[model samples]
Target: MNLVTQLPVSGAAPKLLDFPAPTVSGLPTPALRGKPVPPAQRVYFYSPDEWEVFITEWASGLSYRQIKQLGGSGDRGVDVAAFKTDNGLEGAWDCFQAKHYNRSLNFSDAFPEMLKILHGVVAGFYCRPDRYVFVAPQGCGSTLDRLLSRPKELQKKFLEDLNKSSAATRHYPKQTLNSIREYAQSIDFSIFQSLQLSEMIETHRKTPYFAARFGTALPERTVVKETPVTPSPDEAVYVKKLLDVYNEQDPACCSDVDSLSVHTTYGKQFQRQRESFYSAEALRLYARDSVPDGTYELLQKDVYTGVIDTAEANHPSGLDRLRAVLTQSGQLDLSAHTLISVSTLEDRQGICHQLANADKLTWVDTNE
Candidate 1:
């Protein structure tokens, strides 16, 4: 058997939680982390608006009629639908029925509910890693254990149980035991990266990365824990440096960037349709936008609130102050029309800092 192709044994996955993650952990701390959406479950629990937000973020369609078609009801089940469309392997969405209550999660009642959500997710295409997910703040009793212990047969049984009850459950010809196994393989494990507890416990689970990291050193016949090697000092140093450079370049979040262009931010408008930066009326929204061939990605909020309020209120001191900031932080680049904002011409230190940060920016999102 090809060792690399074989299923990984337990002990090989990245165990960041078990490793006493360094205080200087390059990754963002948990405090900066946002709340996770619920795992799989049936029944709508989120407000109509919250669900709308989730759908809009992940899926493009979110009209009231579309919501009804997507089967969003806030009666008592999951709150948000991250991806509910039934398109293809990539589009096969993981529907979540958020069960957000003031009390702790009841996993015992929720695990079975996850099985139900999976069936509701049925379509011809199989999304890699798994098409279904359960979203709950806290789940029913032993829900995690039950989910962890679920056997192939049980998942099939769960599917049958769901198909029998849901009239809305579209008929999937391959709703058999084999299809469940195939679907199981397609299950996306990306969900674990979000759930703290799921990530913690996954330390003990078997996966490909675990194998690649530790290689084939198995336990003695008598039995004992497998010892995984930690990164050597040299390896750790290289990894740290590489990560530092990588972080500054990746634009998904904070990149030490130079130039970027996005829709402009027109100031608040009385006309319903005139508020967007993309609109022609919003061209005067900023002095920078008036420059030739200028594209604005970020609009300092103070620019709008301060400038507009000053001009409308007929305040000279305000205009002078606003004009001063522009001379310094013009958001200038050679490709960009020379516009100046806050810094003084002699502010060598400020210019250096801006230039250093700008070197990393690529108008095209490098992070993505």
Candidate 2:
């Protein structure tokens, strides 16, 4: 009997089905997906504000959730700050000042920002940061880079530049240029550093939101198909072998082969096996679906190479072996569109045996 669930036309929630809908494993459905951002256009088109967002996201990896972006009016001197707390006492504090420039940043370009840091510290607007970074699309030029590497040389340059500037003399707490020089002399110019565009991009890639940044899908894995309700006699035999491998005792084996998953230990092992199976299956399926018929085997060999390289390291436990297999899965370069063409879990288990007999894999019993 077909049961149709009805809903309200407007201003009220619709009646949900008595039974929940089926869901796909390992797939996430976000409300908004990343848009396609071409590499060439990415850096060129992003504004200063967009750059701050990028920096904030990258910095979060280092300081985690402690990194904060100060965007509104009264930010004192800091643009972004990363604070660390240890033993209930304030630990390390770092600040990043983002400068978006089309051309390379020179000494003159950095001077103003340096003055703000000095003024903020002296005036007690904020405590001095352990590390102060100048972030820019085009990093400091050769002259500034050399000056930064030498503390004495940088300090000399700062004073020399400040003395010649009417802006420094006119502004500040009514102090002579010499007073400013005395204050600057006491400061540790070595705390200053620069982070360029390339470094930020590299850090960003390691983050979970990496695909979202580039508007690309995450690395694809094999799609799971719905198994038939009735299991063949051969299916039952393979299921028992799998149950034994997972060390499941008193498994209520049935025509529904997936029922073994109810046992706690078996469930965890099944997930790990499923993940490895999907990865290996993606490679095999990719080979079959290639433009030219015979190319699949070549691709399969490449996948085998990746798997062997990742999994060959001596692992003491089943958990370690499982991790190695999962790592290899992430390394596979299958597309989301093509990865759906995978074999059933039973078929993949057969392939694992094929690999074992070929000496490609040695499925040793290990404590998980």
Candidate 3:
């Protein structure tokens, strides 16, 4: 009997099978399914040290001449220091104090750090930073936020707390604490501020390290430059090699780029090759701004490795060798490369030409 026919029929309607709904226990949540974590909440997930590192990277992208992470023991309350001049803290500088707490920072959480900075300056540890920015994932609590906006009130509260508690002065003598208080009173408290998580993430987005840090997509590749009407000095090496290949095929076919430009057979071929070369050049420039150092070079190395054996093999002429090696390059399995998604067939062919320009791959075997 067919399965459908074997089912028992109800008096008024066909009976339905009572199969339990399939249980999906291990399915990914929205975040795993490509939903991005908001930067505000995501910063809280970083460890204290990692948060310091993130701030350092973000500061490096700014106009600061130097950035240093001083987060461990004996750091004297500075987490990340951004120097505006080569002289470092001896000159103008800004301080970023990273606090990676589960909750927002309050006046109590910030007061001690402020005292530490004041003490550092008075103790000759370093000059007072031009700006003291508190960097926390949850930002400042309402109470602390209000105090920051009113610099005088914040200073008054800081002094009151300094006298009431020894949190920042336990190891120091009364004279030292007095010195810190006097130093604090002398400087402008307006320098105290807080960096919002959104502001930090926005600035960090301009840096090459953002994608790696946040698991975000890289910026789109820019358009490739149009091939020039005439060969440029930069194209001299590859252009010379292409002329040699054409000459090998037929000595009278072309002697130089000027003659080759008007050749009936090779002129169009030369233009297409230049387009491919520029395509790869565009990729190189994109990789510079989008990926880590040496990423584009690695792609070029991969192309050279895939085609070198074919290039070395015997061929009827230099033109034949060039065609064979380019074919081999096109067939390379570059899916593993970081740039594979943005790469193109033209780029692969152009990279072979780039290798030729570098003297790494010569179509015409001079010794032979």
Candidate 4:
């Protein structure tokens, strides 16, 4: 379909199976098997297990046996169904409407009236659609996000469903506890009762979309203590990149025009710029330079800390590399809170982008 959000959906549900409107002399000519609909839009193409996860959540919330009532056309436009939660209350929620696509769908077909057709969904469920959430997987368009961002009633409905789903299972991030935090930060989802969400994410990572999307998505972060200096694994990568950059920019070979020959060679530039990144004085104290506790204080205390450190603990310059990012240029706009959410927490309910920063080095945990 060209533009799904605006397609021609005037009929309660398009006769998906029937092809070119059949015309009989008297009665409707038996609808010819229409041009085949695309596989992506066809219902049977979806995974049954994943559908069940959504179905159970949706049905259990409203105490419905099944959504079969709306089988082919009843869901109104529900692509994924699930129970929703708010505070601690639960409700059957229809969500992940195809109307709200996960990332944009690339279509070879001409959908001149996709949006207009899709709006019929709004009309279908007009009298209390229960809940409406559009999944914009590749991330919502800025304009669309802005439009949806402050949708108070819509927001409330979304949150209510999420919370309800969470509460029924005791408020958890069945997908990934850490993701809850990320979502809260990225999309500003509420975390008023995040603890409950955390437990759920940990225990329920088996749910279809939950497992697929949030499954094992956390980053690996570790600290290396050599020369008694503390740096994180990512730091090593940053420092390596920085050193390469610095080596290129060092003032070694000069242009004959100015004849400042010192700014041309990598070796000479390395020698000149090396001091800033790896000072003789700092190296001399490396064995004795212990990280101040204030830094790690930020990482560990996030509501979503990890169970184990990480796989990259062996690198000596990891943490230092991250530190360099924070204290240097080309790297700007950082704060402890932002740094705290750097990595993808194994837990999934928290945002760990703090570690995602090049400046995220390991500092001694003050609270330790």
Highest lDDT model number: 3
Residue by residue across 58-151, what tens digits does model 2's lDDT show? 7755744366677455555567777675311134678788877887788877787777666555444445677788888778899988988897
Error of 1 at 213 (Å): 37
lDDT of 3 by residue, 1-368 (tens): 22222223222211112112112221112233566676656777899877877887677569988777663367776877888998877789998899999999999899888887776776666777899999998899999999999999998998888887565557667877776677667667899999898889899888765755665666888888789999889988988899888877667758778888888988888888889999999988887766656777878888888999999899988988988998898899887676777789999999998898898888887566
- Residue 205 in candidate 4 has what lDDT? 37
Q: Taking the tens digit of each residue's C-alpha lDDT, what string does model 1 give over 1-368?
A: 22222323222211111111112211111222354332222114555344333332322222211221133241112233333444322343333344455344553444454543333333222222232344333333354444434655435444455445343233333443234435444554233211222432234123211211122221212221222233234233322322333344443432211111121221111111111212211222332322211222222222333233322342233223323433333332322111223112222212222222333211122244
In the predicted model 3, the residue pairs found to clash are: none
Model 2: worst 10 consecutive residues (lDDT sum): 1-10
Residue-level lDDT tens digits of model 4 in 167-193 = 222433344323332232233322111
TM-score per prediction, in order, is 0.30, 0.50, 0.84, 0.22
Order of all candidates by lDDT, from best down to worst? 3, 2, 4, 1
Per-residue error (Å), model 1, residue 18: 37
The lDDT for every candidate, in the order shown, is: 0.30, 0.55, 0.78, 0.31
Model 1 scores a TM of 0.30
Off by over 4 Å in 1: 1-71, 74-92, 102-108, 111-131, 153-301, 304-368
- Which of candidates 2 and 3 is the stronger one according to lDDT? 3
